[model samples]
Target: MVERRPAGLRHSIKKQMAAVFSLLMMGTILLCWFINNFFLGEYYISKKQNAMFATYQILNMAATNGTLSTDSFDIEFQKNCGKYNINYILLDAESKTLKTSTPDYSTYSQRLLNNLFGENAEHQKLLETGEKYEIQIAEDDRTATEFLEMWGVLDNGNLFLFRSPLESIRESVKLANRFLGEVGIASAIISAVIVYLISRQITKPIEELTGISERMIHLDFDAKYTGKSRTEIAQLGQNINELSYTLEQTISELKSANNELQRDIERKNKIDEMRKEFLANVSHELKTPIALIQGYAEGLKEGISDDEESRNFYCEVIMDEAAKMNNMVKKLMTLNELEFGNEKVEMERFDIVALIRNYLQASELLCRQKEIEVIMEAKKPVYVWADEFMIEEVFGNYFSNALNHIAGKRVIDVKLNRHDNLVRVSVFNTGEQIPEDSLPHIWDKFYKVDKARTRAYGGSGVGLSIVKAVMEALNQKYGAVNYDNGVEFWFELESAGEKVDDEKGMETEESQNG
Candidate 1:
């Protein structure tokens, strides 16, 4: 279990994520405000300038060309002023209003005109002179109302004013700011939540790995990372998990080795006694084969009895004994490697059922010769995790043992039992049941089940021992069960695909019930 961090810790990932999101959102809001305050005004000014220039061209064309009469000109002037939101008064040299586009006399533009002229003859004369004048009406301390007025003398010497208000842009900017505020608040809230959640996801594995490391520092190998993801952090966690397992296994092996070493050092007498016993057994085992070979070779060289068939027979015996010795030595070497933990078990997924069938097929000649019926009970493949080579050796040993020992009915039955995440294969032959006293000693090296049998029928007696070593190396259970009819040798391997079929079976059962 991981301890809770202090509540006052400020460098939490959630806070960091929130801070970064806040900065990004705030920067966006600031940029919106900057564009509204600075560039928006220029944008509005440019639009106003274009509208004024377009209106001037229309009015000047109508007045200069013969395209419009006085009445038609007044209609065109009202249309342009209404479309562009302009209010104006067209005046003659005496300041008489020929046409006015303003519906109300109290408009800001009209009020400005009143304030600028105020019945002053000189001011009226100056404004009517074919010159342009622009003014601003103060609305508040932060804002003002602007109007552009152009005074131009028509070709007939009549004067007119074109006034367009620029205050509509201020309200637009205000509306934009209000919208920006609402959106910015919502964005900040959402981004903060999203970033915080993402940060937790990224940091959760790191925290788990840290806790696992702390436990590992104290030599606890069982604190493994159990989280699953496709991210690099998850991959790192998986690697650390494998490392912990490897460390645990390595340490366990080292401790066992050290204990064995200490025992060996303490019991020098027992070591000497075991060494003597081992050498005696090896010498005794080698003596018969070597003596037979030596005698046969001498007989062949001396041409004893001077018969070709007899010489060939002697040579065959020597060669057969030499082969037996070779097989025994090979088994011994394999046993030594397994017992010393020098052999590396390469694990992979394979169909154990298929392997059993292939081995049975390979031994068909022997089965035929022995008049034995090999029966494999399974049809579908049973996928299991194990060293394929080691499993092959295991199956070969069991099969060979069964063939040599078959008696009644001469039947060999191979059964595969698959359970939760594991598969156990058993080889049973119809033969004499193994003796009760020999059940526990059957896996010992060179301990023959049939003591009367020699190298021709009985093996070096290391097959079962090798099976035990390999099974133990894989950390699984394996043993033999002596039945009334025959002996059943069985061993289990870890499986990778057990749950799939089970799930499918469950679904089928559920559907049937439904």
Candidate 2:
């Protein structure tokens, strides 16, 4: 009996699909974050550095050359800084504002500058020296504010510095922030879409394989999940399909073998039942003859047969019934011993020619009563290793059957031949051909083709079965070959040779064990 397992709801396809989707989504988000915060951030920082470098160049030229008085130099410096949107400022050594190009100055600028550079009173002391020029390039409002807070300036009036416009730097920072925000959103959306598509591509084959496996577990052998193309998923799909096909084939073969075994078991059970019925029939047959013999003997003892002729008749009836009972017992014992593995066959090399001739001579008298002739055809003496008693009984049964069944010319013929390490012997009788439908079952125990004829001839119906068992026990081959006119039962045995004894003994032991 096969036990069924309960279905598990937790391990379904939806759970697997959700797990894959979550992983893919998380991965894409992380990748997009990396590109936005690190790669693009570094890129914008590099552009800012270039702009700052350009600003530094313009401020340095204006501070070193003292070109504040010339409109052409001022215009050139402003134009260079404007090209990259760089802002600059120049100051005298006392930190007094010497030049400026920014317009968005608020009142807080003066305070911030006062805190970073000194007051305008300090400007006079810087002009006293020959080195009266100074330049300052600030990063942005954030950076400058940080510097201003760290470095406090006083009206001590000795030293000062220049500062770039905070408003322009602030504007640049805002623009860079806005650009990065847009890029981050775009990258996240694109990455998510790509990742989802990619995960779908990778997981499709896995999903198909899972489906196929589920169907297979339910005994659906024909499910197929072929891949769409030559990708890893496709290859995975192909491999799974191949595995499914192989598993299906193996399962089919196992089922076929199991079915055949079941049929064979059933057939053997029926045969066992029939064998019991046959035993009962044989017992009744034996008892009938035995009762007759006992009754006749009782009559003789009571002097019921007073005349000599009557006494002789009673005696003949008793002997005849006794003989019949004896024959039945002998056949029964033969079959029983063979079936029970109690009969041991002692095989030896013997001239088959002499055996057949002896059998024919012995049966000649019985055949004469029926106007039947027994004939032998042999090209030469044939030697075979067989049990003398068993082979003789086999021939006797066949000859007897033929004697009863033969019609018209009423002839039984025995032929012998040898071919390469094997000998063939056939017994042919002129009789009605065995029905084709019954040909295959002729060797089954107690199987009668014509029940009435079998009873008339005193046939026990174990003759062909005995022949089959004998041949099998000896490890020889035998079969019935039917023709249009008559049927021939033939058997083949190993040729008598140096190794025949050893092989025959091995076969005998095997059959006994079996």
Candidate 3:
């Protein structure tokens, strides 16, 4: 039974975005409200101070010009005081008003001049100390009025006194509260809309990447990021796309390896069975030779054949069997070397035609003895890449096999045909074709169509196996073809060196016939 995996925690980018943007917007709104509530009172007081300062600056400027008692000074004084909404009094050193902006301060039941600087102990300090300036906020509980008092001594020994009411401030703050409520509502709505749009814009890629991730989790690799922006999110999207490709490739390889692993398991089981059968075949093959050599040796030792000729014949039989065993062992070792890559194939370009011609010349004696007819055709300077010694062995094996198996017309045809980038070298003998069923398996070790005939030739049945292994090690192709009334065993080698041109090939044809 397949076990179920637990689902993991999922984070929603959309909800997180909404929450973050909302909190940010709310935080800004709250900070603005808190500041207005805390500092509005101080802000109003600072404005009154600035107005009073302007009035004082006008008087100081007139005195610096030595024009304090002039009509121009009074004009400048009235203009500055009115502009800053301050009521001013110009007082002489005796503390009596020489000029005043308002003459109706008696309505408050106090002589304004004395009440500001003379009556109040704190206010008296500005009059006594030379160059001393002071500011005071006085609240009138009866009329619910707030006023700022500023007094300073002029450089000309004249006293400058000023007052600015803050009556409008309380009313302005009330109006501000009402206005802020309405504005905040409108701003919140606008901000919410803007924030929502912004959050969507930000989280869109995140959501898409999440979707891609979800699909990737299910092994769907087709979806891809299409964003063209150069943001970090865009880069992340590209990385996710790359991750998808990598995961797809890795999974495919793993699945392929898993299938191969299963096949290897099956093949291992079959190999064990084949090993048992192989041992039986080896035992069978060695048994006959051992029995013959042992019987012949015992016969010689026991004087079963008393004559010298018989003794010599027994020795010959024993030696022949021993020699066959030795040859078989050597062939087995060569095949092992080829199969296991122990045989080093030193590749070199050589004239293949010359190699074949030399091989035929060496076998001339065998051809003559067998009364075999020979046909040879090739192109001159036909170069090929191969291990020369190994190729020579291949040629020898085919030629010897043909010689041993020749029948009927007794003709052996050796031909070299160039096919594209390769040269097919084939040896053909006029004899019975191999059975169709045994064609593919002919290259397997110890496979023979005619067992009796093979035994007669002392064939270990590993020659074609060696041919297959050698060709495979060289990464070349080799096979056999059944022709009419004969069989052809062939192998190919890579064509090397400069190719003979068409014009040169035609001219060399006559010289190539051998």
Candidate 4:
């Protein structure tokens, strides 16, 4: 059963990063709001007080320079007074107004005169006092409005009063804080969304790395991190890719080693079994010849045969058995060399048709004795790539086996056919068909279809096995096919084409004959 992970924002790094960033932004906005609420009002009030002192200085300078009533001074002074929303009255020593910024000059003049005379002193609260001026928070009895007021004596003894409305400054500070709160909330929300999207982009590579790790757990190394980022995450992904490649190569080599180990063990066991079977077959085959030779020798020793011909007969029997044993031993050695890869196969281009004809010519007398008709279907030279000696041995085995088995029509058929780049040579003799069940095992060492018939023909049951080994060494194909009246043994070799010079062909044939 496969396990599944629960899906939720709680387990997501993207969500966590978004939440943390949004919280920081919100915290910053709230900090700004709190600072504005607590300090913005006092800051505005301090700025207004500074503006009033600046007005006082400029008016006192103009009065001393005798330019207090000039149109230039009046224009500059009025501009400053309007910018700060200040109401002012300027009076000479005669208590006559020199310049007044308010439409109702009488009201501001009376206020300034009352301040100098200390009549309205109870209606004021002094904030800062100087040698020539006093700054205060005062209220107007007529309009019930509060002001930051400066009342003082200027140079040349001109009396001046500078006051700005405090209500407007307090209202502006409140409006600014309200505006900041609203904008801060909106900005924090927008900033949070943007940070969340950016965090997701940042985490995309991390997610890819996570998937790669999960696949690695299952030993799949095909998934790779392909991100082109130069961040630490990209470096980590590159490291993981390297680790995955290393592990894949190491594990592949281990698996190959393991498979090779298994094959070695199996081959060793097979070789041991073949050794045991070989010994048993060798012993079995040698038992009869040894028994026959022993019996004939003992008879001759006991003088059982009085006539010289009888003694010669006994000796002949013994010699024949001994010769059979020698032949069997030679075949066994040949089969052993082929099976153990000790036989070196020297490959060369050879005229196979000429070799076949030469072998048939040599065996013509034997064919006549057996009264078997030999038919050759190829007169033209068929050149093929093979070990000439090995191919000759293979052909000899098939011809001998066919000769021994020939019956019915008593005919031997040899053919050479070319297909693509390969030349197939087939030898067919008119005889009993090989049993279907025995066909597959005929190439096995010591396997005979008819044991008695094979024994009569001095067969060691190793000829076809040698054929199998040689064909396998050449990395070619060889097989036997059963027909209705006969079996055909066939083998194929790589073709070397038929376009050789006549002189070269003759030389090759002469070499085989030699």
Candidate 5:
């Protein structure tokens, strides 16, 4: 089954990062707005109070020095009043104006007198009190405006009053908070978009890695992480690439091992089947010879063949049966070695034409005794590559089989024909055509088409089987073909061509007359 990601998690990292960054920015802006709303007014008032106290100290010092009306004192006092946005009025012990920064001195003096006498106290909130001074937030009854006011008695028994307007400061604080809110909202939106874009850049590699892992799940190891950065993400990509390579190699090795194991299993099964078939064929083939040998020996022991000729025939029959059994056993051993790969083939360059002629020459007497005509068509050397001894065995089996089955025209034809890079040696004999169905089984051990005829001629039916084994060992082709006149058996070997040096100086004569 395919794996799937949770619905909520898809593409969430970018969004989450953008959200978190925007929240932090907006939170900082909100905190600033909150401070502006709750504390800015008090801070402004405190700074104004400090300015007023400094001015008062300067004025008190001047009055003590009797320089309150001097030009330098007037200049300094006027500058302080303007800088602190304060309006001040000073009165003598007789209630006459001594120095004033505002033209409305009478009005300020009345207000100060009212404050000193505790009149209009219900309209004032006291902020601080001292032996010589008191600070309060008071409202102007006519204008409904508030002021941060300081009134005190001078050392000379004179009165001084200082006041600054509080309305503008409150408006500034509110305006600042509103402006912060506006900027914070705009910054949050723009920062969110920028953060989202940056987050996509960061998450792109992670998404690619996820895709690679998905492909790996399906056993496809082709996808790879190609990022070249030195970040942790890049390191992870390199690790994943290595993991993919390792897994691909491991899986390939496993598949190879599995295939080898399967081949071994099939080979084992084939060997077991061949073994069973071999045992059955061997038992069947040996039975008749063993029974004959036993029966004849028993007759001799019982005096059933008392005559000298009869006794000699009995002994000869036993020896012949024993020899056949011995020959059959040797052939069986040779076949076994070839089939089991115990016998190694020695490949060498040799003239196939000369080999055939020499074999026919060796069997010329047998051919004459059978009164069969033998024919060979090649007159030149046909050099080929093969295991010389094994090829000879193959040729010998074909020739013998053809001779044993020779009939009708009583002629044997041996031909060496070349096709492409191979030489085909065919042995044909005039005889009854091998049955079509039995042709396929002719190469099986101990499979005879006519059992009675095979027994009459002492044919063991293992020659073709040996031929099959030898040809297979040499990795060549061998087969039989049926014609109207007879059957032709053929085998092929790799051609060495006439260019090879004739080390044996062997030459083939024209067609041999039998």
Candidate 6:
């Protein structure tokens, strides 16, 4: 089977390289476009202004000296301006004449006239008044072709007309674009290679650690991570190595533990199966003997001999043995049902006082036999939500146990009170003190704190276990509270938070139920 790669490692060096390279290319293209369009364009505009100033100075000098039309002056201007890459023009105030160094005059003339002079009367007025002015003029004269037409200006007589060749700037900008493209391409290539190499170096140890992990999956714990890299990767490698060692130890421990758990589960399953089988077996085994003994004892009781005492003794022994066997079978069945998770409880709200009164009535005979008085102090109709039958059984077990264990005057006190959303029912009795060490385990199945005293009173050790199961089934709370005089066994059940108005006859059963 193909193993899965860990999360966060799906992307490789090639993929990362492509992503970085793509972003770098996009950034370079934007920067080059911005410089060519904005910064470099601004530089060209500044150069044009300087050229315009040179033109103005030349004209102003000629105008001062009265040599504005001299051939020598024109030649001197041309010589001084050689290859500055611009057009030269000198116009009278009428704007009817011109001069230049390029032949494509239509586009140049439109731009020149529009920028240097103004429209209609404004151009005329400005020409008459202003000594110098410069403006960008768009042109369609035949002097310039290709590209986005022409860029030039009309000088307002501040200097003899001087124009820079637009072609020179066009060529210079093209060269700038080409130079930037070359530099950017080279930088991107270098960055991609260096970054890819650096990433590979960083990931090398991790890859080795991954291999070690793969080996571990096959129970090959012999391999140790060996690759060394700087801090972070080195730490990662060390962690992987430590994990491998710990995993090996854990696996060894788990092997034995797993075996033990499997055996224990199997043993438990067998015991469960045996428990079911034994219930039937024990019933079959003991029934015949019990019946025979009962028959002999009853036959002897009906004998003509005046031995009433001996007959009564034999009858008591047989009844006692039968009761023990019956109790054992009932407990076995209860435990089985609880373990198999088949206990069903019917839940409803009932008067707590009434339930206790009924239980006390039933257990009064047993309490009297033990010289115990069951004292109940509670509100008349303190209501709680519980399974009535299950709670009754729980109280019966508690009452019987308290009856058997009570010492001296044998007084068992039962109290019912409401606390928040729960109703607490506590049963306290005077008794021999329970051992501190045994309190925690008292809730465990078949756990008896006073084994000798319990057995003397026919305690089966399963009554409390049944009580626990019943409480748990109803999802109620049960616990034991120890005091100096005796132990109080208490439980909490969900209570109905309603108050009855006895004066207005709102205490009707219907209202209380609702």
TM-score of each: 0.46, 0.46, 0.50, 0.54, 0.52, 0.43
What tens-digit string does per-residue lDDT give for candidate 6 at 131-237? 34533332324543321222222344322344554556767887887777777777777777777777777666767777787798887888997765558777877
Backbone collision count in every prediction?
0, 0, 0, 0, 0, 16
Q: Which number leads on TM-score?
A: 4
Across residues 145-197, which tens digit of lDDT does each residue of candidate 3 receive?
A: 66777876777777766777767665676677667756876777777677777
lDDT of 2 by residue, 1-514 (tens): 7675555545544445555656666566567655655565445444545554445544455445655458888787668656655534444445565555555333234533654455543322221112332322223433334111111222222222333343454455566556655765666566656666776666767777777877888778587876778887677777777887888889899999999999999879867975887677677676666787889899999999699999999898888777766777778778767865679989888877678888787777877888887766453456778887888878777767777778756767776655567767777788788898998887886688997887666676778888877887788888876665676777777768523323221222112110
**Top model number, lDDT:** 5
Off by over 4 Å in 4: 1-223, 229-240, 252-267, 499-514
**Candidate 4's error at 484, in angstroms?**
1.0
Model 3 regions more than 4 Å off: 1-223, 228-281, 498-514
Better of 4 and 5 by lDDT: 5
Which ten residues in a row are the worst by lDDT in model 2?
505-514
Please say which candidate is ahead in lDDT: 3 or 6. Answer: 3
Off by over 4 Å in 6: 1-306, 499-514
Q: Which residue runs does candidate 5 get wrong by more than 4 Å?
A: 1-247, 263-271, 499-514
Q: List the residue pairs that clash in candidate 1.
A: none
Q: For residues 493-513, what per-residue lDDT tens digits would candidate 5 score against the true structure?
A: 998866422323222322222
lDDT of 4 by residue, 216-302 (tens): 878999999998988999999999999999999999999999999999998898789879988999999999889999999999999
Order of candidate numbers by lDDT, starting with the best:
5, 4, 3, 1, 6, 2
Count of clashing pairs, candidate 6: 16
Worst 10 residues of 4 by lDDT: 505-514
Q: Which lDDT tens digits does candidate 1 get at residues 1-514?
A: 9785553445866678778888889898889888887788667766665676677667767767855457777787678778877776656566566556766533534444454464322232122222443332222222344554454556665555666655676777778877888888888888888888888887888878888887887789888888878888888989999999999999999999999998888678655765675677678789888999999898878778587788889988988888988988888788778876789999999887778878888889978987899876466656789999999999899988888888888888877665666667788888788888989999887788676663667377778989999999999998888777888888888876655344211222112110
Candidate 6: C-alpha RMSD to true structure equals 18.3
Provide the overall lDDT of each model, using Cα atoms, as 2-decimal numbers: 0.73, 0.63, 0.76, 0.87, 0.88, 0.66
Which candidate, 2 or 5, would have the higher lDDT against the true structure?
5
